[model samples]
Target: MSVTAGMESGPPIGVTAGPASDRGEIHNWTDLFYFFNHSLPECHVELSESTKRVALFVLYLAIFVVGLVENLLVICVNWRGSGRAGLLRLYVLNMAIADLGIVLSLPVWMLEVTLDYTWLWGSFSCRFTHYFYFANMYSSIFFLVCLSIDRYVTLTSASPSWQRHQHRVRRAVCAGVWVLAATIPLPEVVHIQLMESPEPMCLFLPPFETYSTWAMAVTLSTTILGFLLPFPLITVFNVLTAWRLKRAGRPESRRHCLLVCAYIAVFVVCWLPYHVSLLLLSLHGTHIYLHCYLTHLLYFFYDVVDCFSMLHCVLNPIFYNFLSPNFRDRLLSAVVHYLPKAQPRAGRRASSSSSSTQHSIIITKEGTELTAAGPHHPSLHFQAPNPSPISAPGSLTAS
Candidate 1:
């Protein structure tokens, strides 16, 4: 094809040197080479030669599925447990909601990625999409911090004080958390803009003049505020709780401590890489294309971390179903209820025999003999029935 045809066809060129019969002229080396050497310069920006859309779609879809299913399961399993509707549960539910909100924005992000980072959605979407993204992220952080504080309060405060203020505190904290979350994304709404890319089909925009730098700063600050700040507090509280529970010798307390520790560990593991990447990105910018490349790499990696962050949602359900004895028993009963009947064991029937010997109620009381003839027969038990019951083992009973 001719040079013009080559440009139109998009890529590749072939040149031939021979007599030009049509033009009735000689096709020399210079003329032949000139035919292929067009004036068009190669476009500086290039989209991936591969189908980026398909890959991005699959990845984002998986993220949505995993995050949604895990969060839903957590809510479902813990919704009715004793811990359900408690401070911890409330914080977790909020976190799940935040994750869902962020995940909701994935399809939009996928479009941007697929279209080579061009945003086809108008100026309004360009501005608001970021709002959805950061609001949920900040909200998730606030809820996590709330959870840590809840653990701390439950562990350190006097029971009477905690009982009086726990619910009120939780409500106030959650409300403030939401307010903070909503405010963090306002800059995003105000700053985003749309621009043209080399590919007219692609939409591209520069982040507001200083927004990239500002975003990097805010992201780093938020990482510390959201993840690093809460980690130590949560870790210390959980450790103290575990220590206290262990000393108290309560099996349930130990299990609760372990679960909290597991949560702390998971949160750290999942978020640490993302934070590190963010820090690196902040240190560099698009001025270094490597930074831009790393940013894209970190972007996808962060998405994976985002998916795992919602693993916290799955945790509450497991905690309710497995950590609490009563809840576990109920879960087991539910399972057994749905199970098929088991065949009787091939063995001798259990003997129904009973014998009783009377004993003195007190050292001063006279001893006597009593007999029982059947398994179901009532025997003389020594403890007297109390007229009142106490809330705890050592407390005075209420009449």
Candidate 2:
């Protein structure tokens, strides 16, 4: 529906309950949904909306700027050396896109939250924003799983046939993951409708019975698929690799697992609370709706955790850039090629085929070091050749 036309006071078709409720207590728990979190936590206390607006705007703006810059830098660096990139780069590029897409949806959310959860964007945007949010959030999780699986398979398998098919298999799996994540949110988009709570609020209007059952199923499945299963598998692979490396008597530190550990840390720190809180709230949402005073804290906690989880996008680029020496080198290379002042040297470097050797100079807070090997090599405090002198035990380098 058109933005203006969608505001023509559509039917308050769904179940509603409780006195003076902006979100009426539905008699049953049928409206729980995976993507449609359009309801505002009805504040029982006198919380200042202005205060919330200021806090939200600060976070939204900070995340927008930081996530945009970090994601773009990683993507540009990857594509610049796109020709030489392997499956890992491909996955990283996809992850960046997924994270970026999710974070971009926040400005819309910020607008709605600022208005005390009244949605002004009408029907299509209401659905589209939720759709985009879930699509990318799920995609990021799936891509992370894909990366962990890639590492596991590569490390454990030794057969030539497995090696031969690895590239093709990786490409196919990655393609399937994106397509699947993109398709999963269609039902949420279709079910979302706008209703007036004095002002229009976008809501998921799935038949109440369908929500109590299938919607709950969707939420549980997300918890298991998005976090419970993949995260453990990723951890397992890292542990196995560490064990094998130690058995081989290699000097590589267990910190090599740090990249995967950082991934785990982001998921746990950013997402774990959101999922757990969402589950608790979904189960008791009906009770809370009836006894609004009793469960105000639950509602408040859910919104806070859910909103904070968006920071994963901002953190992902920082983790990859700082943790992976390769990412830093590519970023430096991209800056030289694209920045105005570095153009002269970049042009000279590109034109001379005979001078293919590249020197990667990394200046850290503590010192400066140079790394030489091909166009890209490890850099930062972790600079110097492989087996970096500065690398600590448990420190891992990107392949």
Best by TM-score: 2
Error of 1 at 149 (Å): 1.9
RMSD in Å for candidate 1, one decimal?
Answer: 19.8
TM-score to native of every candidate shown: 0.58, 0.72
Provide the global lDDT of candidate 1 against the true structure. Answer: 0.45
Q: Which residue runs of candidate 1 sit more than 4 Å off their true CA positions?
A: 1-56, 76-87, 198-213, 252-258, 285-399
Tens digits of per-residue lDDT, candidate 2, 6-119, equal 111221212122232544544432332211234533444655545655786678778888888878877777666545634355666778889888777777766665666667
lDDT of 1 by residue, 159-198 (tens): 6766667767877888898898788656434543443322
Structure candidate 2, residue pairs in collision: 253-394, 254-394, 255-394, 255-395, 255-396, 256-394, 256-395, 256-396
After superposition on all CA atoms, what RMSD does each candidate show versus the true structure? 19.8, 11.1
